[model samples]
Target: MSYELRDHTADVAVEATGDTLAALFAAVADGLTAASAESVPATGGDRFDVEVTAESREALLFDYLDRLIYERDVRLVLPADHRCAVVEPNEAAREGDSADPDAWRLAAGARGVPLDAVAAREIKAVTYSEMALERRGDGWYAYVVFDV
Candidate 1:
């Protein structure tokens, strides 16, 4: 997985690519951390398990980033590592079995970094207006814009 950061007119833009959705999400999280210059401690002293559901991959991407923003702002959780996956609902199964509340699960490995070490301003939200997720050959790629 890989990520590239670009300067946007208002907010920062991030693009990530990977062989799988899970890898791509993880890379995106890493990209966000890199952009913020948030130092993730080496200890597994703090962490959070996050789950988000959305109707489409694009929506999932937005929700995934938004969750990260929330974690950073509300919980002071600096992402150290992340694991995410996309699960499609089974339409033919029973109602309860068919619908998974977490179409995506993001397990974030985090540890509190010194407040002074965190150099970037907080990210407010992730926007869908310019979001893009698509298949590229045998892998996948995505582009997203965030509101600072």
Candidate 2:
């Protein structure tokens, strides 16, 4: 899995690729962290868990990133070292028989340090504008833009 930050017109965009859906999400999460900070320490920080769910995979990604931004703001930390897993929808859910709004779920574990520990940039929000997620040749690729 890997991720890279690209220059957008005025905002910031991230492109990520992974061998699996879970890895794809994790790489994107890592990209978000990198976009939020110029440098983060390798060790000694607080750890946290985030769980987010949505009706669709794209929505799940949006909410997941938004939640991380929320966490950063609320906890005053710069997140890093992300580990993420995606739970696919069950057959019933996919068939629209399940009423759960959280049919698509993402569980993530991450580490973060106080914002003072790094040179931080303020990311206003994650946007659907120009967002793209797709499967390509046995791997997954994602593109996300952030309003800085």
Candidate 3:
């Protein structure tokens, strides 16, 4: 998996690729952490678990990043190392609940350090602007923009 930071007029965009959905999410999460800090410590000082459910893949990406932002603000930390898994809607569930809001779920673990311990920037929010998450061939790709 890999990610690159692209320059937008005033915000920053992250483009990531992976061989699987989980890897793509992890790459993007790392990109988010990179955007928030100049450098993250090799080892993190705080750790936490994250769970988010959404109506679609795009929405899942949005909520996952939004939750990290919320965690940073509440805990005064700069989020860093991360790992995540995406659970797609099963055939049975998709056939049964057309209006299910939790069709997509993400379970993740993350590590962070105190905001004061690093040179950090403030990310106002995660936006739908140009957001994308899709499968191509046998791999996954994602793009997301962050409000700085």
Summed backbone clashes in each candidate are 0, 0, 0
Off by over 4 Å in 1: 91-96, 100-117
TM-score of each: 0.80, 0.91, 0.91
* Clashing residue pairs in candidate 1 (N, C-alpha, C atoms within 3 angstroms): none
Q: Rate the local accuracy (lDDT) of all candidates.
A: 0.70, 0.88, 0.88
Q: Mind giving the per-residue lDDT tens digits that candidate 1 earns over 1-148?
A: 9999978998988899999877888878778877777455555445567777776677777787887787777766555566666554443133354455435333444444444455666777778867878889999898888777
Q: Residue 96 deviation, candidate 2, in Å?
A: 16
Report the Cα RMSD per candidate: 3.2, 2.7, 2.7
**lDDT by residue (tens digit), candidate 3, 17-100:** 999898999999999998888788787577899988888889989999999999999989877888898888784276574655
- For model 3, the stretches where C-alpha displacement exceeds 4 angstroms are 91-102
C-alpha RMSD (angstroms) for model 1? 3.2
Cα deviation at 72, candidate 1, in Å, is 1.4
Those runs of model 2 whose alpha carbons end farther than 4 Å from true positions after fitting are: 91-102
Name the candidate, 2 or 3, with the larger TM-score value: 2
